[model samples]
Target: MYCFMSTIDPGPPPQLIQLILSYLKDGQSTTEFDLRVMPLAQDGSTRRYFRVYSTNKDSFIAVDAHKTGGDPKTLSAPNQNQTFHYLACHLLERGFPVPRILQHSSDFNFYLLCDLGEVTLCSKVLENGHKNKKSTLELYQKALDLLFKLQTEALINFEHSWCYAGSVYDRNLILENELNYFLKAFVKGYLKLTVSPKSESRLQAEFQSLADEALLAPGDFFLYRDFQSKNLMLKDKMLYLIDFQGARSGPFYYDLASLLNDPYTQLLQTQREQLLSYYYKQLCNRYPKSAPDNDTFTFFFHLYSLVRTLQTLGAFAFLTRQGRKHFQSYMAPALENFHHYLARLSSSLKLDTLVELSHRLYEQNLNVKKRSP
Candidate 1:
């Protein structure tokens, strides 16, 4: 017998439920398994997931990727679902926490995954209410360790035949284009500001430099593009990576930024720096003969962190306005942090001008919100 407990009503869309039942009946006959769809928090992405369960049997998870909404070519240029499938299977073989693949219906855009359970790092931290700073830090450290291991051990060369090389949305392009998400959506779109030509020039120069710095990779590592507080699942005190469809090859620093500088959880500056140092040390310790030196690591960390921060600013606004998701409260403090960090990093007049323009727009938005009934 299987038992299901959901944070939300039902499990998934009616069609998906029917598909699962039909597939199970057609393919295998074990004891009846109960499906659970727990409402885990989601980010801007359209991907949806649920937890699965069965009595005295291994539990699992499921994903309804129906909203990905396109052919493989349209999704990301080259369309490499096979690579993701292979990588998941390979990683699972190596004792990673990815839910085991029980079944997949490519036509329906859904997959049944081994449930990794309901607890996440975010839920635990929030439950403890931030006063348990040490525990929070430790959880973050464990996550980073898992990430570092994945990059160094599991991701190297793992058969690149399915590589999406034709995709124009590589690191350089992703960084360059995604900056507009911040500039247009967050700065101009959400804040709704007008700036002098001088200010605009500065903003462009600032973003351009940051993009250039971030485009360099620390050897190609499989980037879980949306690795953050939400996509991580904690089961039996271990962290597991979920929502990995956006996985790709990029700088190792990419995941680090997504984790440490997450908008939902603004870890204090001192704590963040210490975590960075710890991450750097772990990387060096693991591949002592192969890893980059401390100075190089610091440069990449700062560079990629800025890129991620800007990308997140745009995602927050776009997700709220277009996707109908409410993430404004989470983004406010993150924007403030971005402004301060920009002030410290950018010395050019053009860059400073852009920062000032963004600031003006941000202030005005706050005023508007205050006056709105």
Candidate 2:
């Protein structure tokens, strides 16, 4: 979980260090500062981060992300550094709570951002042992309120180029890329199962249907592709959003699904419903005439939840395959959520092969857990 990557070939790269120091000094000479740099815990991304400390106790997060050839399948932007910087400034102007981008390399391969501290919503939930339902509900309500703002208010006259996935969250992005990512990463790689040609056909059809249903949801709002607790930072008891480079104009229900069904938080079914109802009320209050009816919203919620579940499982499987111990910890819970959503849709969605494979994987996971000791 703690990964330290040297910023330079030898010691801390002097140029990068000086760049950060100059920014801290407000474009003045960098010679007057004493600085300390330490690696922070790594997340699911390949980007390397360091917490830079100053003698005056000022701190900033330094990110080093090398440029790479683009992959269409990735949820991250092809140029995440630039995308993050642009979006941060854009959202800040709109009164959204996001880290400030202090400075950046001309190419945007590296940057310094306001340090938001170490406590994440996910960590806070775990710290509570997920037992304090009342407190947890309050936290989620706060998150939901922030999400509403992100999806609505900040989106006024939004520019599409600020998003990594362009302006729109289209059906191809949902079905072909995200669903197929699940097929490749979780089904084939992790589960180690081969689907017959007929089953593969059926799976594709089911995924397509889900995407079509999601696309019909009633709003062209901003969708934070990863709106879960882990990407949410809490500093001074105020929620700050991060890792939003993948945001795009999409159905609002997708974000709602992402938050409520997040495996990291593992909110109980009743709790999930309460939060969903709360979000619906807020949505209606905000856009009374435009907000979809409860039945329509519920339909897209399930559809998007299923897609989000698959996407999470795929990421977990891919990360685990790459030997990332941090993501490995989430695999069991993700599988449980996978089963939970699949079961809920069994009567409505025709995904027999995927269902069977998921059940098999669940049993296999349970057996592994039993034998772990």
Candidate 3:
């Protein structure tokens, strides 16, 4: 027999709750009002979310992005609330399906957004048992279409300061931030293994080469740094994007890689290929001059996929180490995807040591699970 216990977390402070209620009231008078606050499931980020329910059953999401030590701005560049508000408002104005910012505190630390219900594309994929390829492909196609709009239509007169990372996704950011993140978070932290000086040099060189190659692609489009099924919400069959505060200017391949290589969805190889072809065709049709040749685009797709996979593994390792148990479930899948990318790369890249280390980490995780009982 299994016993389950539920502990309800009393959301934000009473004063904060009242302030949010007043904002929702928007100068309207109600004889009797009741409000219920429920904490939502936490994600890898430091942001806290609560669903606010009123007597009329109207709902909105309250975000308490108070000054957490590890706020994204500390690592990225812009204020979390500011980036979210700017990007949300920008996308919403352009007819993109993002949550509307209903209200925000004067200081911009807290805000209310349209409640986009609980079903994410990731949840929908899981509900279908990840076997309904047809349905899954349709959802992905819709997501890709929306992404096209973000890259093109949303780029018109975009402000760089609005992005958390103000600069375009450049080689240095890729090498210093992303590649180093993988080394520190996954290689050293998670696997408890150290890279030899020679291996480290080799890894850095390879990363630099890959980043340079990826930069050869166009750099004018918006890159959704974490575009995946988890960030996509489905309401009434319309897909909405959330958690886009990390958006920046970069090659289009980055977002494509993120969506296709997303471990949460674990899209099959054939499905990914078909989707890639679909996206390429759509890009050519829509922006003929901007789209790169199929070969060049595919090359960057693979490279960006590797980068995204490594960054994701780094995040999983870092989060788990930080005592975020919710991230632990993603470790094995992330490792699997990491291996998938490593296998696809050429042996001449000299990533054999990294590949071996990843396999050892995967095996070690399995051993730990076996011993847990």
Candidate 4:
């Protein structure tokens, strides 16, 4: 279980409770299952989770993510439920290890899903406490194999319209959501640093240049925006994906960067290089005509790794500011990652200000550590 998680009060709402019970009733002989709702630990999302038990059946995961507990049509934004349900069914049909959606309400707010085991890949890696244990490396290899399928086979017959915001992951998104997020959230919010107007203009120019490099990455593949260890659940020796509603169309290297540079496991450079070579070999075997050459792919890998690290720092800073201090601890590793990738691509990207800021972040982290004990 996550140390950060605690039981939230009052449990799920009334409508969600009734929906879960009714679904269980229809299948069971006595139609009696668990009505005692137990709250489960939540991720970085706004959704509420609960576990419903049963004597005959294994168990079920109950989700309550309603915008409001009112009429179904009252939802105004692009519904997360619709996207999750569609993606879950789509991936399941394609032999992906996603949870099966057992039932849902008319609004699609509440849902009952098969309980995937409680162990996340993050838990397994942390427990090992070694960066490159054979077991841990094996698990990552399996994850990469699954990732290959997700980018290749899953793209066939895939409809982008069913996705939430849109299909494409464009330069504008990079500028606003990611690069700009680093500028606003991390540089300003977390570090409490101010940027001069002239320096800010220079930063925007650098951001655009980085965005252009990002667009040059190889392949037309499905990008699992948050494909980190925490989002991967291990069950019965297989890894399953979760929290993938942010899936979009982008270059394959972005997700690779997310995985290899993930702060949770803090994989060593040697491990990362070995895995990169392994995945590249897989790509060559499958898409020989389309796969990028080693030098080109390596360049984009470093570029995208830098881009992904900046975005992660922004997210970590924002989450920490919101009172999630656990996220703050992760920032240390992420900043270390920022330094690593930035140093590699130091010549290619003109991020002098960001480079200095990263140094400050590191120093601040060290200061905090010293002040602690």
Candidate 5:
């Protein structure tokens, strides 16, 4: 069972809550009363969210984003709340569906924002109980359409004011950092598997090739790093972006893999392909100059999908080991997606060599577990 979270009476402690009430009063006179705090979901991140109920009126979301929540110094650069504010302002101005920023306190590391209420894309799909094929495909197409619109109209001239914001998302960084997650935690710590010097050299060579494909990607649009179903909420037939702390100027395919092949809500293979084609058609309608043909987009799609799958494997392992979370449910599905790439690339000498070494490590770990008292 999941751990029980604490409740806040009336609202969060006086100072911040008081400030929120003050801001609400300044904007509009509503019902004339104090705000009440109600705890909401605190995911694996350091941030905690709350629903603020006004006396006999509607409720708004109060984001208490202290650096000390779980990850230390979260308010430092690339903080979730700060990125949300930046994207919210930018997207909303361009007529995209996003939550209205009521007010923000950078010093306190909290924000009083217009609540989106409780209806994420994942919840809506699950609430339907049975996975209706038609509905799922339609929903994904809708999501893809929004993404296409954002990439074309809104993200074209996106400027990076902050220092870290302008930095290119190197593929080497993605592979090197995420590879450490599985190598250090799962293989070394949990499974107690050691890599020989020869194996390490072969693994590095395979990763170098994969990173080349990922890094060669064009930095076209503003990539919302975690643009999965969990971070997407539906409101009035539109998708709203959330949890955009890691937003960066990166490849077009980054957000594409995040949405279509998300472990949280698995879209069928047919649906995934259909949605990709739909996005390609819609996106090409705008930029006819550098539009990719059918075959070219397919190649890029598969390559990005492979990169995303590897990144997710490492991320889920980190969450399970370090965060003490149950992410085994996601492991199999992620591996299934990863296996597609492995099957195609099996003929490659470096890939085959690395897979052989990795399988040996897995076998050794299983044997160690069996022999343990």
Candidate 6:
């Protein structure tokens, strides 16, 4: 359906284009077929994506993840590009559904991948048909099932250095990336709230306390840092995870919270609780020896849900301020998610400052609101 009349914007570099053209040509003349590159809509990250259309092949997904002229010689602190290359390769070998890496040029800073098609779990969720829910719920559960498999099975010969955003989800990452991100971007920047020195100290202590509790979860499973619907590509009636460059070793609850608390789908609290119970049962079934009991697991699940809520809000606010206006729409729903987890944990937990802030955000109806960033 994408028609190119005349304008052909030169995408990527000459060498990268040659690689793609050569691969697609498959021994034929490059001039014998039409080749076009079209930009794809991207999320909050700096990486750019494109779909390369060719007359001969099914098409390829091209990624511009970094600026040219720097190849990562070491795995330590590898950029998103290196992480994608190694992780995608490893996952593919493990029989996961990651897009096939066809070709990559380190000097040109480009990667050509098998196109995974246009369907995302978010599109399936937002459709109008009621039958979509019946089927979508099954798919959502399947996604959870995949999450569990990835968390457990993929660790056979995993290397910690493949993690681009640090090797584990520790107190420092929680404080700086999640908690402090919420404070700086969502509270202070977006909501325009000024924090007093005393309140700031109290908040820091509360964040540290939260980090401690989150670390208490049993089993260092793989945590897909952004496990929401939009990050899942639905193909062949199955869910395939994307945007996993931030994957690292961490607690089980964080990812469950990410999928359940996702604002893009806006799942009801009851549904979230049901799914949480489903995932918990799986945990018990698999790790009967090491699993936390029902009560303990529920407590930690809600705790991680609250942390995930904060991180989501922070990303929403910060990205929206940076001119990604669509994220504004999800702000209200994310605020509701914050309220949802806060209420669930109200009996066993109480962070008064966060509670107050949630109330304020709702009062504003997140006046600057929008979707999952």
lDDT of 4 by residue, 1-373 (tens): 1111235456778878778767766756786433455788665667888887755666789888886234547645446678787888888888889988888998888888888878999898888767448877888899899898898777776788767766778888888888899888877877777788887887788888888888877547887889999999999988999988888778899888999999888887788988999999998999889788898888888888888888998887787777666676677777778788788777766878767766766765653212221
**What clash count does candidate 5 reach?**
0
Per-residue accuracy of model 5 over 1-373 as CA lDDT, tens digit each: 1111345433365555765667757757463765456678665665667777765446778777765332325435544455556667777888877778777674536777777778888877666543587777777787787776665566654556432343456765666655555556555655566788887777777777777766766776767767788788887767787776566677788789878888777766877878888888876887688877776676677777766777787776666666535565676677667666565555542476557744664454443222221
Worst 10 residues of 2 by lDDT: 364-373
Q: Which stretches of candidate 1 lie over 4 Å from their true place?
A: 1-15, 23-43, 50-60, 69-84, 159-172, 175-177, 195-202, 287-296, 347-350, 361-373
Across residues 1-373, which tens digit of lDDT does each residue of candidate 6 receive?
A: 2233235544565666667766776767555777778777777876667888977888788877665225677433677777777788788888877888888875436778888788888888778343456676777789899988988877667788887678788888999999899999988888787888887887787788788877777647877789889888988887787888788888878888899888888876666777888888898899789788888888888898889989998998898888888888887788777787788876665577667666776775656543333
Candidate 4 TM-score versus the reference: 0.91
Cα RMSD for predicted model 2: 4.4
Better of 2 and 4 by TM-score: 4
Which regions of candidate 4 are displaced past 4 Å? Answer: 1-8, 31-34, 67-77, 362-373
For model 4, name the residue pairs that clash. none
User: What is the C-alpha lDDT profile of model 2 across 203-230, one tens digit per residue?
Assistant: 8887877777677775578888889999
Off by over 4 Å in 2: 1-15, 25-30, 68-78, 363-373
**What local lDDT does model 4 show for residue 344?**
77
Provide the TM-score for each candidate, comma-separated: 0.81, 0.89, 0.89, 0.91, 0.83, 0.91
Q: What's the lDDT for residue 316 in model 6?
A: 88
| Order of candidate numbers by TM-score, starting with the best | 4, 6, 3, 2, 5, 1
The lDDT values for all models are: 0.67, 0.78, 0.78, 0.79, 0.67, 0.78
The regions of model 5 sitting more than 4 angstroms off are 1-15, 27-34, 68-80, 106-108, 163-166, 189-192, 287-289, 346-350, 357-373
The pairs that clash in candidate 5 are none
Report the C-alpha displacement of residue 237, candidate 3, in angstroms. 0.8
Q: Which ten residues in a row have the lowest lDDT in candidate 5?
A: 1-10
